[model samples]
Target: MRVALKYICEDVDRHGNVRCYVRAPGKRKVRIRALPGTPEFMEEYQAAIATAAEAPLRQADEAKRGSFRHLCIRYYSSAIYKALDGSTRNWLRRALDEIAQEHGAKQVATMQARHVRRLRDAKAEMPAAANQRLKALRALFSWAIEAEETKVNPTIGVKKLRYQSNGHHTWTNEEIQQFCERHTLGTKARLAFDLLRYTTGRREDAPRLGRQHMRDGRVRFRQAKNEHRNPIDIDIPLHPALGESIAAAKVGANLTFLLTEFGKPFTANGFGNKFKDWCRQAGLPHCSAHGVRKATSTALAEAGATPHEIGAITGHTSLKEIERYTKAARRGELASQGMSKLIGKTTA
Candidate 1:
């Protein structure tokens, strides 16, 4: 009997036997391995259909030659783009894709600095996002120039919007205590807190931590940002507080210390969202994982650690970045020292 089912196909072999398979768009064909009309056949067919549903949609046809889309497509396949870190590639692709979607039909050689400024000014409400778009366009055109795809860089001379604001909020001692009281030791929340607080790792680096990183009483791991281009290997002594939390949590033989409820290692974004939920539950809605890192830097500076010393722990290559993190603490420390010198109490 001939059966009619969606995504199901049958081919007769030379031996007069028919093989059934589930052939879905954008997905590999899976052999049903069961006779048609059986439960097994339907089960496998359903699974293949689901897989196809989850597969990314096929992209539109390639743009005409010398179009903006064509240029972006070439840039995407270039060695320069491929060499970028995974996160960087993803973000850059997203930014460029948005531009290509809007202006893909335009000639790449005709783009001017005014067009770049227009794109940047469109997101004027969000200065950071505007700057990011400009930054992505600059990189794309720069590569195109190097590859001889185009002679002009439209992004040239486009200034990023200036906005004054402190970055992530630095967690206060009281906020830390509140979170600690809410999420006691032996809990994942507390473990996450200690990891960021004591290790000075960014949110992106936290999910990568595991027992493998522990060696010679120090935690050693490469920072995730710009890892492929300029890897920064951090090797710092483990703090007793973090060690206590890790021990209390009783992390099993997982490759990573932090795991989702499904027992899989967390993606960076996933970990950050989960950490945010943990903070909310602790009644510290404003506290974040990065705030802990800032707090660590401030604490270290207040404890008389030099900028270089803070840089060593935080994996910061620039002294200016370390200074920004410890700015308030440094001011307080200098004030105290200045007063001491004036009062002749420097010896004490």
Candidate 2:
């Protein structure tokens, strides 16, 4: 059923609880808890609509001065939120907005550690989602505390959920070979695969890469995610595999090697969706864009590239990320050396 405006829709699941939310502008759809017909819900819809002009200024200057909603609005306007990349900012806004709508009237100074933990526990099944929500909340509280809007940050000691599972399955050499064999050179699939595997850039930055970044056979770009905080200029020499794939594909005047069906440059999300289709077509549903990045790091580590070398190419700020690969490579190297010495003794 239609809820309030053209922007909102009401959803009733199999169990029959209703949820009303904004349905348009794609990414900005927010599910506000109040029902469509209620006076309170109408007021909220109006407030959300009204905030289009000046969201934070309205909150700070309005009557609900010390409320949690006001604090969130203020935080959104704060430099902390502004510094985040597009995707991160979107996620943070959604998380903070939900909290604001729920506990908007509550005073930020009164929030305790218990409140933070309870918020975390609500998304118990998905550790990542739970952590993301908690992270956004922490940023908000931390910003508030710094501004002296609140005396204590509620999320100070609340720990992230401990879970076991390899996050994204890192593709092995065999899997990469299989994918390549299935999707031969001269195809978009191969080009996309080679672009990510060869460049070792995150999926977010993949769509932004093109011929312009190339200089003396190296691809260079500032990483989109954490560019400001951990700024590093990435310049990776073209991998032979990627060079061969690109040569075969004969990519034309398009800005990036990957493009949509319409031949337009892809948005970051568009490229990911297109790549997933390529993987499924190759019967390598288990493989992914990010997995290709892992494979690149693994190859470098196995080939004896230092953490600093890996960081230079991948724009990684911390040694911790490449430590696993380096450690494994060291063990393999030692084992090979020891086995060779043993073989020499037996032969002698």
Candidate 3:
């Protein structure tokens, strides 16, 4: 029996049973314990290849292939997509799916400016989703152009949707206290809340943060979002209150500070769902994991922490972002002080 030179690797088990595996880079191996040239062998091989076809970027030469879907496939397989954290990749995947479903059959070169705007406008109601989709499209075409899969990037000039509010709402001190009262000292909700409020860690990084990240009186971890482009190393000094909550939760040697009912590490998305439930229980439906992060930033800025100082704890590489919060805090202080002076003058 003659086996093809590619995708199939022959190996033997310790029990002396021989097997053929369908091997693809960055994918799990599929074993078919059948001899080559048999119908069973062909069947398994075709099935495995079909499954492998769904994953992008495995074939180094595929960048030059087919349509928008092909470009996205290559994009997904590229180092850029691989570099994203789980949550980011999940969003990118949805964006890619949206792009492929709409214009996948079209040639990459045919994606003009108007076409890009059309896609962006379609998602105008959800401004954030629209912007994120545009981001994914930009990444895809940018990769396509650089990879020589396309001549131009249509998403390059397309503007993001204009929304009224800033990204996430900051939690108030009163709301924080209310949440604390409901969740209590020893509960997982309190621990999780403090982990964000004190450490200034994003939701994606917060649940994953554990005792392992703690060393020399600081908790350290890399920021997961867009890590390839602007990787951030967050080293926050351990806060005494957060430390107390950690002990109260009996976090133990469980590696992660927060665990599921089954004693496994909480995934970013899973923790978010649970956290939402915790918020609802506390009658704070408007609150979010990111809101707490913003709250901490606002608190620090209001207390006169510099932008760089705030960025250091929050792992925000962009000073502009840090400054936006600082500027807002400064305005609030100015308004209060100015009003106080006016009232004092009136009384005198």
Candidate 4:
């Protein structure tokens, strides 16, 4: 069999066992055990491609001692960065890589808090992005200080930009109805929507969910985020709507309720992008999977559920996090009840 993917090499051993490896330049050959073209194989292949893609830049950074890129190269190899979760590591890597590309040649020792502040301010137009960049820089510099790669942490005094934002837009009741009316019960879009709405799981958690997580009319799983540091286990009773959607949609022997068009499970980022396309097709350009989670919290809050009660469904670890989700709804519900009592007092 012929393989067309770049840098992929396959060998047949004397006993006729097929061995595959990704042999990219400047990096050690990584063995890929899964059969070619399978979902597992492609996942491993894509990861190898990403690591190999960094080889060229890493090689260049090695020659420039004490430079920012050199520091980044060291940071990437550090245990601190490796300890992060996959999605977090990817997010931080993209931010740091962009910074290194622009200012790779600068000396690490010269990066003061002022310099870091300037970088933060330069991206002020996008406050969230600016804050994210600042956060990535702080982590990099903190790691460098601990490793003795640098003396001082330049991001010590730097603060993230303040912005008034409600974060992801929560889907309204009307919007939910609109989406349901458009997608119907048996469609993949509806199942995806139902999972988001009823389970209230994060986008990353959705891909990992399957029949294995369901038992006795409840779904239980640990959140993907910070599972290593502070694991939060959530067990939510299955919603009738979600159960109906699952039965209506096509379910094969696959472990997950949602699978790619290729009949394989989705990566977190991949599913999010696919969900966006589904939303667009339903004429919901602004609504998203995260928004549905927020909507679930809002519904519970408006129904007079306490913050702790809401946290049970959302798997929020702190009262503060749940409050952020339910504050508006709670206030409105309280005001409505107060006004109804005041009207009764006046009539009496």
Ranking by TM-score: 4, 1, 3, 2
Candidate 2 collision pairs: none
Ranking by lDDT: 4, 1, 3, 2
Candidate 1 C-alpha error for residue 56, in Å? 8.2
Residue 165, candidate 3: how far off, in angstroms?
1.9
User: What tens-digit string does per-residue lDDT give for candidate 3 at 25-59?
Assistant: 77798887645643235435755675566646334
TM-score of 1: 0.80
lDDT of 1 by residue, 162-195 (tens): 9986888899999999999999999999999898
TM-score between candidate 3 and the true structure: 0.78
Better of 3 and 4 by lDDT: 4
lDDT of 4 by residue, 1-348 (tens): 544888998889999999999999878999998766444576577777888886467566668999999988888788878677667878898898888888998898888899899888889999999999999998898888878898978898788888899888999989889888989999988888888888898887887677777789998988878875678898989888878888898676566788888666787789899988988887899988899999988888888889988888888878997886577877776798889989857753
Better by lDDT, candidate 2 or 1: 1
Number of clashes in every candidate structure? 0, 0, 0, 0
Query: How many clashes would you count in candidate 4?
Result: 0
Model 1 lDDT, residue 205, Cα: 85
Clashing pairs in 4: none
Total clashes, candidate 3? 0
Global fold similarity of model 4 (TM-score) = 0.87
- Select the stronger candidate by TM-score from 1 and 3: 1
Q: What does candidate 2's lDDT look like per residue over 206-302, in tens digits?
A: 7767777776887888776777566678877877777788889888755566666865556666678878888888788877789888888988998
Whole-structure CA lDDT of model 3: 0.79
